[model samples]
Target: MAHKEPPSPLLLVRGNNRRVAILVISILSLLAMFFLTFSPHLAIRHCGHGEQQRSMATETMSFSSGNTNDGGVSRRQARFTDLNDLTATSQAARNEEHVLILTPLKNAEAYLPRYFEMVNRLQYPHHLISLGFLVSDTTDRTVQLLQDRADELLNRDPPDDDSSSNNTRYHSVSIFEKDFDFELPEDRRHEFEMQPLRRSFMARARNYLLSAALKDEHAWVLWLDVDVIDYPASILTDLQSIDVDVVVPNCLRQTDENESMGYDKNNWMETQQSLDMQKKLDPDYVLLEGYFEFLTGRYLMVDMPTHLGKLDKVPLDGVGATFTLVKAKVHREGANFPPFAFQHQVETEGFAKMAKAMGFGVYGLPSYLIYHIMNS
Candidate 1:
């Protein structure tokens, strides 16, 4: 009966209070552990810190998952973007244009191979070059050779670039095999005493070539002598870059190491003012054509404006066509090679005089020299 007695109320309440106290202490201990373990990590994230480490982790994940389809597609897209950039850059480098090269070869059989060499050496785009030949009264195989070569050049690309897509440029040949023989002896034919007749003949020949070769679509006309032995491959581009109305290079004839002298008398220039002054001093004064300084045998080389720093272009009363770059407009606007006496100047000199009267500038490069074939 004593063992079965009911428990006291105060004892029960005390037991409940002790259990509650133990529960509160356990909860406070759990909260303190959470703050201590995670507070540093949270602070670091909120303070914008450890960004480099995060980036490294992201890159590591990307590399580890690189075998995925998404990674492969991204890599392919980046490669395509690079290829597109390269193609755009290369396409911008093709600076193509139209140009005409005119040559008159009567007995140029010997020079045919060399002329082809010059053509091969030309740096201009092959598609942009239109070659024209004027062959008349030729006793040699010049006509046949020129025709065969022109056909070959037109039908196929140049020897160097087989993949070139530029073969549309047409080439032409004109043969006037008529005999234009003079009754004079061979020695007297090229004599200085008979210069007017010789120059007039030459002028007539030049005019015929110009009339036959000119094309309105051609922006420029390069009068190149087949006998030029030495010249830069960029000669055309160099002169064109000057952006002048008309320009000529210094043509030189080399005899010996010490005996070389300037050639192409037409390049030797005098201002109109000086020529007029000379005329005033002597009304009948004649400017001897092709005249040069004594002892040196070179034309009076004078200073002119610098074209590309390496080349200087002097204003001139006359110009030589041996290496002349004449604008097509100069001919289209009424300039031609005068065969008759123009102030006693004939042939190319007369052409210079004619061009000047027509308001065209004639310039010469003193330092930029092109060599002529010996005895040509």
Candidate 2:
């Protein structure tokens, strides 16, 4: 048999090298594990499944959640296309059109969580919509809490598949943050002393957000404040039924004197005495064409593009930012929150007036009400 050529020494040496390679790999893997256990970013990066996976998960959850609970009531599972099935720019815009309720906030820690939870519990497709959160560089834990809740929303299960319950539209929540210009002192806010021109900073923030939200090409941008809580899942349903450019969810504010009333403008005030009287009635109240019970960025809706047209022509005044929806197309055309908007000057108001000049009508949804908790 020729003694099988006596196993080559080179082969033995190669075998030894393989063992050393394996040993080095094993050591490095252990080191990686050590870091992963202690470092969040490192763990997410090295694991190669950070934001990308979360985004995918969001899509999948949303897809599976389709019609699972029609109107927050359990129902049969409905067939649905995956997010990948969407094609064309308009398709993306349509997908985003679902609705984006933005909560413009500054120093709103105590009330932010409830606001987010209400959105989360809504009986509509939460996954179909995105939440734009405009936050001031906060001094408290509001931002951190938002970040945490955002993560939790992404990880949450799709609405229960059980057919017996009426809890359908609840899906995962997605919150996006854009840059906020927080140059205004809290003392100068509309709820405090009405410094007409000085309070423009908040408007700037709202305008910048409108620009950012339109960039996403959302169908509608729903604006809300951080403190107001009483929003029903059916709020969007009511707004979507209308063809108007903007839909404001009018609500009643529980006043210090224990009274509640409609929160939209009944008529424009011609005299300072009337305005002063209304202000005395409710310090933050601004008399418009009609008195709206709630408008202070608590919950307003806009069709981005149409609203953008209005912003381009002049400053739209007296329309509360809260619970309002605007068309996405109009918003994109208005120039995404152009710089110098928060000048405590006229830039922000200019956009609103521009919207009015462009002939965008603002409608009020009195049937829908959001509770306003004025903390300012």
Candidate 3:
């Protein structure tokens, strides 16, 4: 049987040809499968087509993360050390009696320079006073201008000559720009921005500053508007004269009338100085109604040594927001007039009512009324 297997060479050659043909067919089948299964995927990956598709998708997202509630401490409020305790300790150790001037502003770039100039020109003891500027959303260059002015003030050297030499020295001026409504929704932005026109809102904003002023332990708190200029040397003397819980210095609102209408057409401004002038002209000016006397809007003084409880419940008239002073202790104990009146109510009638409610008398500091230029 072994001798029979080596009998033919032709038989061995045919068997080898059959084996080669089967191997060629298997290789062609594997190549066809590789092209069919992987070509499209490889092309897409090579051209970055998958990544391009991902890039074409668009999605928008908004985020809201900040202090939202304006009412009071929240349910989840953090436990922290009470500032009052620190304030008490600091108050005991304080040497210098400081005054805080809280000034609020909006888009008042054109008016702020004059206001700062007036404040700079003040004859009060600058070393004892500090200014706090409260600014809201200002679309214009008001904030920038204010910053520039602040830089100038920071760089200013003492005057070479003292025209009205007293104990007056330059005090510190601070600018606080808060975005009270910065995160307001697009639809609610207008409403939030306009809330200042409402009396309640104004009261709240002003009261907020009172807490801050108290925390700082200021000896006095003065509220001011950004539009008025201070009289050259009137602030210091005016502050020294108040003895009651609150003092309302009159203000002026300058008006222009056409000469064609005769004396009625004459331009006039009821200023802070004018109110003091009216009182000088008549001691019973506040008592008189429809007396046609102008009240000054540039100066107001409050004796903060007494209770500020009246501020919480009082309804104000159209009082000016300039040259008003109060005691820091009173404000710390939660005494503040409703701060949200548009323009003048809190400063006028609201201030008066609050004072009366606390069994405190209101007096006019006629001598302290600062000369507020109306047309400037």
Candidate 4:
């Protein structure tokens, strides 16, 4: 405009480069903003998908392990602060309580078939039940029979469809082999004279099984004898409904005739006479039940046939484990079947005494009957 010379080529090139740099910077800034605005939503969707997959896997793996002595507290157990809240209920809601069914076996091959049959017949959810067996000093094929039964139940195919009602698979099954070296002839096993030593050995076996098999996930411990043949399918829920720390049902010996006689005299209420006997006996003296030599005058559950109400609960000072259902916390809180004399009692009775000493209630359903196999 004022006689200016033509612009230099080098200067023109430098200006064009500056404009290009600015355009590139502007595009990069806009792309970063777009990613920042939407990244959180994508991240949240991915994280939720991962969590759902983990939950489903955990449910499928629950108690599928075999023969574990780990007894370590599980994450699931830690999540439960009060197991009583999960107690069995008759309400329409699902039953979340986990029950451990423990049995002590000695030459029990004959009973295993019927025992597992009875277990299968139970109406309680099998997925919520775990089985523990202690095969101590067995001369028969009890261990093999037990293993076969466990395999049959655990390895069965799952239901064909979600709507199928047949589900007999147990949550877990554990088989423990320990020899207590206690043996008696079949004919003389129940002799009153053999009671003390026999019960002492039994106490040791029970203590061993309890320690080896009990797990933190178990909400309840059910001591069911292998010889027990017949019970209501609702036995678990029925006992749990009582909600006592320790509870037992009257175990009656099965008869060819329809007569009902109490078979487990161990379920008794101590009398003042029994207390006096305990005070006079040596600290090591173990008391015997169902014998006349040491009649402590205790009230026996089997003797209470008149109280036949299914739900009638009677406070007990001693309990038999024939069909006992105990809150797991009772055993966790240091109540166990004493291998030694405890308050002049041993075995299951000693367990009751120990539980009561720990400030837990002991009870029995005097008229609620569970049948024991008839022994000749």
TM-score of each: 0.64, 0.53, 0.49, 0.75
Using lDDT as the measure, what is the rank order of every candidate, best first? Answer: 4, 1, 2, 3
- The lDDT of model 3 is 0.49
lDDT of 2 by residue, 242-262 (tens): 656654655556677766544
Q: Report how far off residue 264 is in candidate 1 (Å).
A: 0.9
Q: What lDDT does each candidate get?
A: 0.67, 0.52, 0.49, 0.82
Superior by TM-score: candidate 1 or candidate 2: 1
Candidate 1, 215-261: lDDT as tens digits = 54566788888888889988878888776778888787888664566
Q: How many clashing pairs in candidate 4?
A: 0
Q: What lDDT does candidate 2 reach at residue 212?
A: 58
* Pairs that collide, model 1: none
Most accurate candidate by TM-score = 4
Models, CA RMSD each: 22.5, 15.5, 20.8, 10.7
lDDT value, residue 275 of candidate 1: 54
Q: lDDT value for candidate 4?
A: 0.82
Model 3 agreement with the true structure over 1-376: per-residue lDDT tens digits? 4565553534455766867867887999999999998897465333377765654332111222344453575433332332353221123114455667787666777787677667766555566677777666667787788788766665666566654543344366666666556433435523433333443444555665555544343666677667555454555444434434444444443345411111111112235564455445432123211223432443222211113322222212223345555555445554466653312334234554454555554444332333344441
- The number of residue pairs in model 1 that clash at the backbone is 0
